[model samples]
Target: MSEAGPRLGGRRHSDERSSPQRSLGQRKPARTITIDGEHAGRRLDKFLRSQFKGVPAGLLFRLLRQGKLRVNGRKAQQNHRLQEGDVIDVPELHVDTAAAPRPAVPSTLLDQLRGAVLHEDDDLLIIDKPAGAAVHRGTDVSAGVIEALQHLRPELPELELSHRLDRGTSGVLALAKTPSMLRYLHGLLRDRKHEIERHYLAVVAGRWPADMDIVDAPLRREEDGVVVAGDGQSAETRVSVKRRIGNRATVVDVRLVTGRKHQIRVHLSHAGHPIAGDDRYGGRAFNRRVTGLGGPGIYLHAAKLVIPKPDGADLVVTAPMPRRWKALLNSDL
Candidate 1:
C-alpha cells in the first residue's frame, strides 16, 4: 500500500480520510489526538501499538495498507516518526476478540529488580545488575532488566538506559530516570569521557605482570567466528593488580579508557593473562560458572563508576567483588 510516511508534525497540510469498517454490531466513533511532548520522538506503529494496547498488530498494518489510518488526515506509514503538536485523526479501531493484553512481567523478575536498586534520586537509578540478566529482551527472551524495571517503576514515563553491560558481566549498571538526564550522560561520555571513570575487577588465569599495566591496542571484529583485533578502533584499558591467588591467578582493577566491545576481556587476554574460566578467549579452563549471572558465567565484575556532576563534586559508586572467587585464594575478601 500507501507509503506516505506519517509527517504528523514540523508543519503540516490537511487531507480528508475515512475510518476502516467496524465489525459485528455498533460502530465506534473516531477521535483526533494532538501529539504531546512525551510522545514526540516515538514511532507511529509503536505509538499505535501502545495507544490501543490490546489490539492485534496485524490490524494496524492492514489498516495502513488499505489507507484507513491517517496522519494529519492523510494516509501514513507505521514507521513514521511522531512530532509534538502534530494531530492524528484516528479512525474507529475494532478491538475485539483478537485484542490481547500486554504480557505481564513475572513477579520474580520484578522482585529481583526492586532489590537491585543501588542508588536512586530524581535523575538516575543505578543497580548492581545481576550477571545473567539481559539488559533488553530479544525474540526468545520473555523478560529483561529494562522490561522488569519498567513494570516496577511505571511512574518514570521517560525512563531509559544510560549505558549497557554485557549480560554475563555483572555489576554497577545505570538507568536514567528521564530522557534529559540520559542525553546529558550520553553527552558527557562522548564529549568528556575522561571525567567519568569505569572500573572492573576480573580474575585472570595467572599472575598479571605489574609492569605491563596499560593496554593501548586498537580492536576490530573479524569474521573468523568472532574476535577482537589490533587494527580496528582505538581501545585502551589501564589495569593494576589488586591481589594474587598464590601463583595461579591475579585479581586486577581494570579502568576503561575507551569503551570498546569486549575490551576488558580481550585486552587482558591479549596481554597474556586471560580471565580464568574464559572459554572462547583461551583460558586454561572454560568453566561456565556464574558468580553474578544473567548470562553464562565470568569472573569479571563492574566494580566502580565515577560520574561527573555539574555541582563540581563527582559521584562515585562501587560494587563489591563476587565472594565465590575468594575460595580460589582460600581467604576472605
Candidate 2:
C-alpha cells in the first residue's frame, strides 16, 4: 500500500495576516475653538461644521436645532450670528459602543402591538405606535422602536420613521420603507384635513364626573425648554372617565383635539387630577405614592390610535402595558 499515513491533499496550511475590524464605537475626539476677532459674527453651527471636516452634516444640524451647542452661553438659533469674544462649546459625540452587538426586540413590548391592516403594499408600513418610546434620537433618549425595527429588518436600506411619539404619550407611528413613501407620509401629517383620530388612556389622581370634558389651554416653551404657558397659544383636549379605579384615582381616556407639547399632562394637572406617576405635573403626594410602588417610568401608555389608512381604510394600533406597570397594580385594585 502506498502509505496512507499522511494524506497530503486532505489538509494544507499557509501563513496569512488578517486585520482586526474597526468597531462602530470608535470615535474621534471633539474639537473646541474660542470665537475671537472676525469669526465671532458667524453662525455657531456653521462654524463648527467648518471646523469638523469629516463630521456628518445632519448630526451637526441636529445639535444646532436642539440648542445643544450654545453661543455666548445661551441657546442660539441655527441662523443666529455669533459675536466677538463668544465662547463656543463643542461637546464630544459618543459613538454607539454596542453597535457591534446584535440588537434585540424585547419580548415584553410584543403584547402592545395592535391595529388594523391599513396598507400592506411594499415600500411602506403604517401602524399606530403606543406611547412611551420616542420617534427618533434625542438628548434624553438614544434608541427607540424605529431603531430596533431597523435592526430587525436590515434589508430595507431606506427605512425611516415618519413621525414622533411623546416619551409619556402614545399614538400612531408611521414608518417609511422608501424615499417616496417618506415624502407622502410627511405631507399627510402636515395636512390638517386628514382628520387623524388619536386616543389615550390615563390614570389620574382624583374623581371626575362621567362626562365629556374639554380643556382649552395654551402652551409655550419656558426658558428651560419645558413647555408651559399662562396665556400661550390656544390648545384643546377632550376627556372622558372610563371608570373609577378607586376614590383616589380615576381611569380616564383622553382625545387630543389639538396636539400640543405636554398637553395631556398639563391639562390633567391643571384639572387637579394629574396622571399617576407624572412627577413633573402631578402633585408631590401622588408622585410619592407612584414612587413607593416601584416607580420610575411614567404610568401613561399609548393605548390606542386611529389614522386614515393608505388604501382608503382606517389604521389603528395599540401598545400594551409595560411589565412594570402591571406589577404596580395591586390585585385588589
Candidate 3:
C-alpha cells in the first residue's frame, strides 16, 4: 500500500472513543459518506469493523440484512469492495453506551504510547503494547490501542490492525496505515506460507520437563473460557526452559508454531504447568501466590517477533520484561 491518499482532518471516525459527545441512549441520524482513496478497495464488513470497533460482526451483518446499510443507494453484500467516490448509506444507529466511550484518551496514556513506538514507516506503525491494554475496543473496553492512536493522529487515514495481541498479553503490535498494506499483512499472517516467529516469555508453576520440547495439541475455546485440548484446531508451541526459580517456578520461552486462541495457556495448563498468574486456565493457586509475590498481570509477555518487511528483509521486534518481573524472577527475564 503506497501512501497515496489524502490525510483527512478532524477526529477520525475510526475511533469510537472520539465519537461525538452524545448521551448513551441517544440515537444517531442516518449518514451518507463518500469513500476516498485511503479506504477504497476494502471489504465493506472489514471496513465497518475498523470504524465501529465496539460493534459486533453479527450486529453489523444484521444491519445490512435490515437494509440499514447500503452502497450507492442499494443494499450490498458485506464482502462488497468499496471504490473511490462510492457513497455509503448508513442508517440510524444506537451507540453502545455500555462501552462507556471516553471523549478523549488521557494525555498521559497517549504520551506513554508515543514513547513506546518501536518502529514507524510510511506503511506501518509498530509499538510495544502494554499488557493490560487491548488491541481493539470491545463490549467491556471503551477504547484500545488503535482507538488511542486514531485520537493521537487524527490527520492519518484509518489505521488497520495487521495483527492483534490479547489484552492480557503485551508485546510488539503492528498497525497498517493504509488499506493495501493491511491486506498484504492479513494475507501473510493467514496463509502461513512465510514463517513469522512470535516468541513469548512466561512464568509457570512447577518445573518444566527437560525432555518435553514441544506441545502439539488441538484447541477450542469454550463458553466458560476453558479451551478444550484434544478437540479443536491444531495448535503447536515450542517450549524451552529458561530458568527455574528455586524449584518454586520455571521461566520459559514459548514460540508459537500455530497461533491459536489461548494456545500457550491451554498447552501449558494441559502439561500441568499453567502460567503463574493465568487464573483462567487452572492456575488460581499459582496466580494468588504470584499476586503475593508482586508478579505481572498474567505472568506472560509477548516478548519478541520476527516478521518479513515489504522489502523482504526480516524485522525483529522485542519488548522488555517489566521491572517487577525482573525483580521477582531474580534477574531471570
Candidate 4:
C-alpha cells in the first residue's frame, strides 16, 4: 500500500501551527496506535471515542465514513473489528472544522470573467461554468473552481459540489450551502429530476445540417480505462449545426437531453465528425487542423444552461467563447 500524502485536487497544507484564530480552531495531533497483546478485539469506533474525549459520535462516524479513520493504512468500515497487531490511523480533529478550505481565486480576474448565475437562493448557488477550469480534484490537478469558491466564501457552513464536470467540458455546477440542500440536490440528480438544462458548443470535423440529430448510444468503461460501451443502455444527445467554419469543420451546438458520460463526444465521434482538438475521439486529420489554427486544448465549451429557480422562476446563464477559440476562427484553418 502507498503512503498517503496531500490528496490530488485537494487543499494546500498550512505550515503555520494550529491557532485559535484560524477558522478551524487548534487541533490535537493525530494519534496512531498498534493493537498489542493486551489491547485487542475492540470495535474501531468504540475504541476511537474512548481515546478522543469530547468529540461527537456523529462527527466520528462521518470521519469513518469519509475514510479518514483507517486500519493498517487501508480504509476500514465503521463496524470493523480490530485484532491484535492491527494499526489504527487516527486523523486530527479541530474545533470549528465544519468543512475544508476552498482554493483561492484571483480577485482581479473574477470581475472580468462573466460567470452567469444559474440558481441562487439563501441555501444554494449554481453557476454556469466554462470549459477551461476543472470542477474537482483528480489525478493530475489539485485546485479547481469549487475549491477556489470555497476559499472565497469560508463562512459558508457546508459548501459542497453537487455534481461533476469533465476537465475539458463544462456546464451548470451546483453548490449546496447546507447539508440538507446537498441531500436534496443528490436526490434530484439520482431521480433524474434535476431540472437543470445543459448545452455545449463544439467545432466538429464535418458539416452537418441544421436538422435535429439524435444520437442514442450506451456508454461503459473500456479496457483502456476510458468510458466506452455498445448500445446497452439508452443515451440521447441532440445536435444542430449552427454554421460552417471551413471546408472540413463546422460549428455545432449540442443539447444533452439525457446526461451520460461523454455523451456528446462519443456520439459525435460515432457520427464520424468528432469534436475538434478532442484527441481521444477526434480523428488525427481533424486534430491537426485545429492544432494548426491554435494550440491543443479541446475546442468544446459549455455554452448555455437554464434552470428553474428555487423561488418559482427561471434562470438562464451563458458563457461566451474563450479568446483562443475566437483566435482559431480568425486564423486560416
Using TM-score as the measure, name the better of candidate 1 and candidate 3. Answer: 3
Residue-level lDDT for 115 in candidate 3: 81
Evaluate candidate 1 by giving its C-alpha RMSD to the native, one decimal. Answer: 7.3
Q: Which of 2 and 4 is the better model by lDDT? A: 4
Please provide TM-scores, in order, for all candidate models, with all chains considered together: 0.72, 0.59, 0.77, 0.64
Q: Write the per-residue lDDT of candidate 3 for residues 1-333, one digit (tens) a residue.
A: 223322344322221112354454656655566776667888999888766655667877899988778888898899999897777776667766666455556566677688888888777788888878878777887678888898887666567788888787877888888777788777777766786788999888889998898998888878887575566898889999998987778989999988788889889999999987786885677677777776648878888888887789998888888666866687322
Off by over 4 Å in 2: 1-55, 58-134, 140-142, 168-172, 225-231, 327-333
Tens-place lDDT digits, model 1, residues 184-272: 68877776444578999998767789988898888887764234555688888999998886676788999998887788888888888
TM-score for model 3? Answer: 0.77
lDDT of each: 0.72, 0.61, 0.77, 0.67
Ranking by TM-score: 3, 1, 4, 2
lDDT of 2 by residue, 170-209 (tens): 5445676754456566666566788566677787887876
Candidate 4, which segments miss by more than 4 Å at Cα?
A: 1-120, 128-130, 170-172, 190-194, 223-228
Pick the lDDT winner: 3
- Model 4: how large is the Cα RMSD against the reference? 11.6
**Which segments of model 3 are wrong by more than 4 Å?**
1-5, 8-41, 48-75, 83-108, 331-333
Of the two candidates 1 and 2, the one with more favorable lDDT, higher being better, is 1
lDDT of 4 by residue, 249-303 (tens): 7888888776767778888888778888987888897688688777777888777
- Write down the worst ten-residue block by lDDT for model 1: 7-16
